[model samples]
Target: MMTRSRLMLAATFLLLSAPLAAAQDGEPEVDCENAQVQIEMNICADRDYQAADGELNAAYKAAMAAAREMDEQAGEMGEHYVGAADALKRAQRAWIGYRDGQCELAGFEARGGSMEPMLVSGCLADLTRKRTAELKAVSAISGN
Candidate 1:
């Protein structure tokens, strides 16, 4: 009975570890920057997305400040403000929805595969970088 129980336990361990072993088998074999495997590529893509997001946040803040200043100046000058600040807020919300939907759809190329997340991240990074440029341009135009 004792030998049988040990055998059953060993089998259970192997069964549980099968997926983990498969995942580990695909490891990058080096640092993420020089990643040579799918899993590492995904991780690197995610990191790139994160960096882009950080830059976008900074650009957005600058743009928002510029818009607020434009609104304030127009109000003080007794001119029609056109609600630049409010428009920026609304546009940003819409952009967030658009970006997420686009990235999710892009991920469908990889579907249930391990590469799906990498595809989504890459899309996000590309879109975010473009948005950052747009925001910076808006800030420059606002002269703020």
Candidate 2:
């Protein structure tokens, strides 16, 4: 029997490999909006996740700025040093691990199937978007 980590690793490998294989074969650029086959779907899903990741990065930067602002305010007001930025950084790191593990578990339902990569990527994209929104909201509330 395969371990859970092995299952996740295989799915991740396939997700990474699909684009390279498609490119090497000279496949036309995928129309993600109308993806038909499993490989194309997987590639498009990965692309979506990548785009979400980019947005997440931007949100994280904004959140960090807000956190620093919070820290500065606390220091100026003679309140305890909030260390907001450090706390946010630690939370973000923990969130990343949680998101990866959660998405891997989601893909487990389709393990060893062509759909596993797509499932994993879709979960990643969805979770990343949610995290981005959360970060944006936090920044907005904390003096962004």
Best candidate per TM-score, number?
Answer: 2
lDDT of 1 by residue, 27-93 (tens): 3233666787787788889888999999999999999999988888789877675489899899999
TM-score of 1: 0.77
Indicate the residue-level lDDT of 118 in model 2.
97
TM per model? 0.77, 0.80
Model 2, 19: alpha-carbon shift in Å? 9.4
Error of model 1, residue 40, in angstroms: 0.7
Report the number of the highest-lDDT candidate. Answer: 2
RMSD vs true structure, all candidates = 5.5, 11.0
- Tell me how candidate 1 scores on lDDT: 0.89
lDDT (10s digit) by residue, model 2, range 23-108: 99985488999999998899899999999999999999999999989998898877677788999999999999999999999999
Off by over 4 Å in 2: 1-22, 25-28
**Which ranges in model 1 have alpha carbons more than 4 Å from their true place?**
1-30
